[model samples]
Target chain A: MRWDFASVFDNTDALLVGAAGTLRIFAICLVLGLSLGLLVGLGRYSRNRWLHIPATIFVEFFRNTPVLVQILWFYFALPILLPFQISPLAAASLGISLNSAAFSAEIYRGGIQSIETGQWDGARALGMRWGQAMRRIILPQALKRMLPALTNRAIEIFKMSTLASAVAYVELLQQGKLIASLNYNPIEAYTAVAVIFFVFLWPLVQFSYFLERRLRRDE
Target chain B: MAYQWDFSPVLANAPLLVEGLVNTLRITGTALVFGVALGLGLALLRLSPRRYLSWPAGFVIEVFRTTPPLVQLFWFFFAMPILVGIEMTPFMAGAVTFSIQSASFFAEVFRAGIQSIERGQWDGARALGMRHDQAMRRIILPQAVKRMIPAFMERAIELMKTTTLIATISYADLLFAANEVSQKTFRPLETYTVVALIYFVVIFLASQVARLVELRLARSGESTVH
Candidate 1:
């Protein structure tokens, strides 16, 4: 058997489209997941039972289950309860974003909790409200510590974006599947896909390591 | 129109779901045992004084860690057979992929755990006429393994969740069984929901156990490694 990449190179257009789809979903999930996570994390940190109970439940349920299951649930089961059919992208996005939210919520909570009480007290002494204190003082400091974890989460989200293909969303893996089936070159096609992912993720993984090392040194 | 919720179809397919769950555990168990053992070996090789052994181990860990598992799965399941001239079953492919995948992660944990031990301990061992391997086997590993329990449990749980990906390759894991039952019953909602809940229960219990172990470790005043 001989190794050939000519077929994969000829299908660069398909891979490019898949790359765009993967990036699109990654951006969507990053924004949705992190922002939603902040709210849920605040809920988890809240003093009220009303906020805390539901947030805890949400985190536990999503975190405990496999992400693919969540994606499948949104894709296949969710539409039955709604008036309209769900798009593959929508289903995939919802599942990935929500699942990411659950994981990142813990990061947010841990970051916030790690803040020294002295800082919170200082904010209160300055006559700042809870929201003001959190936004102006707590989050800024917490964010530095959270940066490594959040970067890790972003990488994870990028990787998880491949699951969108399970719902027939036009991601890199889905495109690879298309290319392989069409050209009958599963070896080159899948190898290309794996290399593409490694190339895309290597820098991010390095950045995360840099952040972690820097954080460890600084702290 | 109110679409009435029905679980009767899912309930009737209990046997299938049970079998799926068993397969899931089987895969998880196989992967966990091999992953930990292989992980330790990789970690030790990575920690080697020789460049050749360390470099290859580092490469394997980094490559596996860097790429997505599904891509690896596809490469192993679809791409591997042609290249190696051997037929590959889904279970075989899934097991191999996950064992190496989880092993890469476990390698890091083991490396950290081993490194976390103070240099004085090694010095003490060497001063006691213990050879490197002798010190590592008896003195270093026992303590490292204790600190590593929480991280190991967490990884094992993650591995279980990851086993769901095998379903994509047509492995009759729980998630695959869900798809089969859902199509058969024409009750996607009930079937998927049931499977999700089943996953939730099993994983939740496992997580609770992990948490309990971590808590016990903490209470016992053991410093755990991530």
Candidate 2:
């Protein structure tokens, strides 16, 4: 069969809706994943066994498994283990958030560990408590140091959200597939989806570059 | 419905999984070899003084580096046939996609390694009557390749992990086998856990190989440093 660009363009509203859904998932998961990552990162670095073991296991399991499998597990396996049923959207969000947390935890740990010992010592010498020092001094610097990496992770999570389509979530890719199946124009539909990703992703890439340059200048 | 944990069902399908494991390694190994070759070429192209050559190479690097590999893979598998009238088998599609996606990152790694070599080395090689290619072949590349070992190892491990994506397009890799078993046996958790363990083993072995190369490089570096 021949390619049809006109047919794909004719269904622009459907594609736009899918793009909106993708952005929503990305925004929600970014916030949730970063928060979870911070907690787990801090937990992994903590001396408490209660915090460390669980955090380590969480990071290792998610990081090691293929994200598609992890998405499958959340969508299929979790409801069997848990008491409550979850919507596919919720499962997709949770899966992405959890997977991203594993990666972000490592990034945060690296950022936090990169802070000089003298910074902590000085904070403590200034009569700040451990929490006070971490919250007031170490964390601010670490966050700045980590901004570039964190943004990169956010972009990754956004890309990975497309995998949710495999589990039957009507994200951008899923919508593209639907359009392709109906129109029998896989190339144009998928290409359109890719362009949508490119448009959305290009800004994030620029932002990451800007952050990296700014961070280097500050250094 | 109560679920019972049964390893036997998965064990019965071990042969399929084994074949899948072999296929995964085959794809990873082949892609790594070709990817490095392509990457080296691209790196040289980028470092070439000629802007006409380097600019296009640079664009390829950025496009592949920024775009997700899965999307690229789909484009290769799905779009290439329409665009070029050449249909690729799933395995061929996987290999080409992996290699292309990998070349970009490997090119960056190699470029960084090459740049780390001092300019004095180039001048010294020129004074010794070596042609540009000869100088690079005999002097520059040996040192750059050695410095690039760690980064290349890290990328290899990443490539190993990423081979799982091949399963998406129905290549019978370990991940695809796990999905098959999970669907048939309804024990996705166990099937996926086993698949993850197998990946860990493969990646761990790749890491070990990296370590050995690193040690060998260090020994050579020490001898040269003296």
Candidate 3:
């Protein structure tokens, strides 16, 4: 009948460790997912059938399935094919990174496509190669438009770090589980976890919204 | 030695997988219906002229949208029952968590769709002596609902994918079934692969259908809301 956060406060060290673990995976997935997404997005934009087809398939396959399934598959199924077992961090990171890549590829593609054909023509008129033009001219401009969406993706990746706990990874949610079980304070334990997440993510969400509004205003 | 791939064990447990899939769909359907209805209510309250109504609705939407669904699920499944002094089944917890989680998302879609309607329609209805509720029901909503369809389908597909998380709470959804089959048959590779493929096929097909609807809406010259 009484709400007590004292137990949760006493376990601050555990939560801090969990926060570090969550941030580690989030950073790994964010960098890997978004950077790789640029390549896959380019592939989707490519005229070459080889590049386009495989990119399409990759995006479709990864985007279509639930990410937890991917993590579990990597953790349980993939080890059988490999010479060694997959670490929880590796499996969770791979699953989240690939899923984010698939989703973010579309964002990248849409951003690139939103650039007018005139931009491409101007780059071509300047004797710039495709890669040079993409890097110097097209992407810089497209990235501005993609900023809101990409930030949204980053927030999503942060939230998804919790799924690492499902594999018994030492993440925020996993640590929360440990604390709750040990202290028998599920209410305080879980509430603290949720509040911690909300504290971390609310600013990012607000930033994305701000970016979206600015983009809308500019356009 | 290369690991040998085997499918016989997974195939032998087709019925279990099927039941798991059915449970998955059941949760998705239950959550989708409630999510949409509650989303509409939330959106309406958010759009209310009164600050008291709009503020609380906005708060709910923001909190739900900002937090991780897994954390929400855990809180509901593990924490809520004891707080309220009642027992909750995994299904109940999953349904409640997903419904509210998805409703927050759907609320935005509804809000955007409603706002996208030209202000002239409302003025026209007013000129025709229609009350606010009457105009909303008869004039505004019909048009907004059409624009919202593509977004609705997209969110529904997302909801289905998200339902997989219930397995972590020991619900016998498709992913949980895969775990069971893998352990029982000692064929984790084949079992997980089959389950993943099943998810891929169903979700991919749903996505394609959503795309088709979106394309059709575009061709019909009806601009849709996200």
lDDT of 3 by residue, A110-187 (tens): 999999999999999999999899999999999999999999999999989999999999999999999999999999
- What is the fnat value (0 to 1) for candidate 1? 0.89
TM for candidate 2 is 0.91
Candidate 3 residue-wise lDDT at B69: 98
How many angstroms is the interface RMSD of candidate 1? 0.6
Query: What are the runs in model 3 whose C-alpha is more than 4 Å off?
Result: none
Please tell me what DockQ candidate 3 reaches: 0.94
Interface DockQ of candidate 1 = 0.92
lDDT of each candidate versus the true structure:
0.96, 0.84, 0.96
User: For residues A3-29, could you state the per-residue lDDT of candidate 2 as single tens digits?
Assistant: 679989888888878888888888888
The total of clashing pairs for model 1 equals 0
Summarize candidate 1's per-residue lDDT along A88-196 as a digit string, tens digits: 9999999999999999999999999999999999999999999999999999999999999999999999989999999999999999999999999999999999999
lDDT of 1 at B142: 96
For model 2, residues B1-226, the per-residue Cα lDDT tens digits are 5666677888889998999999988999999999999999999999999999999999888777776677777777877777777879999988998898899889989898878889999999999999999999999989887788778888887787777778888999888898899899988767876777777666656667877877887787722110
Q: Which stretches in model 1 have alpha-carbon errors above 4 Å?
A: none
In model 2, state the lDDT of residue A186: 74
TM-score, model 2, chain B versus true chain B: 0.92
Question: Highest DockQ, which number?
Answer: 3
Candidate 3 matches the true fold with a TM-score of: 0.99
- Give the per-residue Cα lDDT of candidate 3 at B136: 88
On lDDT, the leading prediction is 3
